[model samples]
Target chain A: MCELDREIRRWRRQEMRRSSLSPRELDELEDHLRARVELELELDARLTPARAFAIARDGLGETSVLSREFARAGAVRWRRALGYGWALFALSFLLPALRFEFTHEPVQVLSLTGYEVFWAAVTEGGFRHALCNLAMLLTLPALWRGRVRGGRWLAGGIGLMGLYLLATGLSLPRGGGGFSASLQVGYLVWAASFVCAAVGLWLRAREWVPTTAERPEA
Target chain B: MKKPVYKELVAASSRPMVLSILAGGESYGYEILKQVKVLSGGELEWSDGMLYPVLHRLERDGLIAGRWELTDEGRRRKYYRLTARGKRQLARDRVSWRAVHGALEMSWGGGHV
Candidate 1:
């Protein structure tokens, strides 16, 4: 509300637009700066508010270096979260994810685990689908390493695969031998992995977004 | 009043120092910096901004947990406390530090080699 506080707010806004740090990080840094500014003022009664603020900010280090350090730390955190997602995805395969029900006289029923469906897709005419799955799997490592291109590719892959899964899960697919395939509980769990990856990527992207106004460097 | 000459040593020791401080209780960034200065007798020189990244790393590694709380003055401040994992890490770190300290003490006591 005061003049110095307004100046600090302006500085925070500029840093937020220019740096990759999240708003929470900017807030934390702002709090630290304010504390240091107060201490500076206390140490030297002759120092003006602006001078105190400048001294405190300088002691906090350059924004460029701080941003770089935060980016590195964020990458490690994101990679760890992605690793857990990949583990969940890998484990989903061992669960029965689909059920095949025959409308024949015997009313026979068959169930396939995620692993079976994966292999079935590979050997069957769904080779293209298998390739898509493999490509999505490959994107995991690249995305984990915080590569922008990998994040984009993985987002696209998740979108396409999610749509495909949703469509298939919502409708009973009629195949040969009067059999209809319905998604089971395990299938939903497998689909949850996509949700996990999507959320992780979304959070990572949310961490850095520049404002439209290009304020000149402070 | 002598500033540490070795930047690497300062950086390496920061983690253990912070862990030991947090082991006493939860504290915020400015308070932690103050404690570090006091504990080091003003010998440990650290830029105010350098501590956040280290804290973030510690939080990410599960060594410390950070949470935001409103002070009685209505100021929102982030506080950090050591986790169980961090206590274990501090114990291990203490062993390593003492070993190095003992070696140095024995060598220095002889006043040579």
Candidate 2:
């Protein structure tokens, strides 16, 4: 690598240390900086390495400013992901297992003993619903984890989720014994959210893409 | 030579401009900035890295999405493209831009009855 490239890389390392962004995000930021530098070089053949680096850095703006923006974006999304994920988790057990034990409701809860509750949870539709919530809950972390380091896995996960949603949406209760319309709509909403999140995550996932020769540090 | 664009206008319009441009097709950061300069006849000068924040925010809001891919020149570039949400956003931006232009024309045009 050239002297300027080394300097740029060192500067990136420093910024990455100070920033809370993930490694993938840091790599992306570096990619952006390099792009600016290359563009500068393309437009001007006579510029010195130091001069070009300065111009590129200046154009990309101060590291702190860019870092702050990325940090904020990451924080906000993580918070949303955590919140949504936890809510699903809490609702799963609270609405089914805990509600059965605490509220004395015989409708949803069949067994008073531990084994009975376990069996009921597995067999009962309400507990099954809660399990679905648990599955949704897992998507949040896996989605982001996949975004950072597992692009192909995330793509496959989302693809499977899409298939599941399609199957569920298609096989709606065609006038069941005790099936409610609102519950059906809830399934649609949950499935739609999953599909939306899956699509968004799939688009952002780049780990599976082959590293180009230009990505020296990658 | 055209005069430099005001910083605030450039900052404010970056989101809509990016969304609108991507609506045309996918492009990387450097290419997008170059297109903006050409489209403005070299009038608008966006602060070098300012668009990154805007792009990040849009992605967070689900307005646009990006991917890192190889170019024909063997350079790895982060390409941005409009998402379905971004398309809807551009439609809104188009209406708002037209309204602003209409207002400006009405204000600057010859006195009307």
Candidate 3:
């Protein structure tokens, strides 16, 4: 991180020590302040970090005023994890994904959760399905941070895979069964999960476009 | 040659102004501030701290919803968007503001200043 970045973080920590503002609120303010500083720096190449930081800080108004405004407005501490929340919600739907029936002998029915199926796939060399799921899971944090380029489409593709699995039952490696497999409600739920993620990511992407586009190249 | 808008008028208009801007889409504090500056052509001056309270109040009234999200640069920002309730409120605000504007236009047009 640059010195200005460190300074901004330190300023946020200092405000947290003395203000009624929640950490999340402070985080918002900090980003606004940092944006102001970036604009200031970009507008004038000769501006020092201290000068730019001061300009941004003062532009944000006093901490006391902000606290009072928040109090008067009845601001409450709240957190939102848009993309992450949707991803986790999607993962939860996998709890009851598949039902297995044995047509041999005494007609037995066995239900398997997504977790069970995942492990079964892993042990049975069903690497393709396992890897796809793993890749989706691994990409979430990056998506949350907006680090993933073309993220909305990536999320949509994940949703499409879930839809494919829903339409066609989970394809696992041959395990010597004389039974047919059908997708359960979990597949549908997972599809909903991914759809939610795609929408959430797209909205997130939309919110930031103008800001980045408006920023003057320095 | 821009005339400064009175602080009272700004305060009175802040709620609808925010609702209207957010109706475009979800936006963060900084971006919203920039929009206000641009749209008003810098005639309306709002302190950065002043807007958050308005946002908080709107949220308290269920006129808007705020969420935290990271920018592509990984900076955390709190984005606010109009709720269904907020849209309805904005519509009502439009009707009232138009009434006021029309009344003023009539008076000004009739040389009543």
Ten residues in a row with the worst lDDT in model 2 chain B? B68-77
Listing candidates in order, what is each one's chain A TM-score? 0.54, 0.41, 0.55
lDDT of 3 by residue, B1-113 (tens): 76799999999999989999999999988889999999999988998878888888999899999776656786666788999999999999999999999999999999997
- Tens digits of lDDT, candidate 1, A1-218: 27568779888888756665666677678778888888898999888888888898889888878877876664454555555556667776888888988888899889988788878878876675466466557556445334444465566577567557655663347687588787877677666666566656655555444222222224
Task: Calculate model 3's interface RMSD in Å.
Answer: 6.7
Summarize candidate 2's per-residue lDDT along A73-157 as a digit string, tens digits: 5435434543453443333233322112223333342223323333565777546444544555555654443333354465456
Residues B55-95 of candidate 1 have per-residue lDDT tens digits of: 88888888999777665544567889999999999999999
| Model 1 alpha-carbon drift over 4 Å, by segment | A74-161, A165-197, A205-218, B1-3
In model 1 chain B, where is the ten-residue run with the lowest total lDDT? Answer: B67-76
Candidate 3: where are CA atoms >4 Å away? A76-218
Q: Which stretches of candidate 2 lie over 4 Å from their true place?
A: A80-218, B1-3, B72-75
- The sequence of per-residue lDDT tens digits that candidate 2 reaches over residues B13-102 is 887899988989988777787788888787778766666777778887889887767656454567779999999988998899899989
Give the distance in Å from residue B76's predicted Cα in candidate 1 to where it truly belongs: 1.7
Model 3 clash pairs are none
Native-to-model Cα distance after best TM-score fit, residue A111 in candidate 1, in Å: 27
Top candidate by lDDT: 1
What's the CA error at residue B38 for candidate 2, in Å? 1.2
Which pairs of residues clash in candidate 1, taking residues 3 or more apart in a chain or in different chains? none
By DockQ, the best candidate is 3
RMSD of each: 8.9, 9.8, 11.5
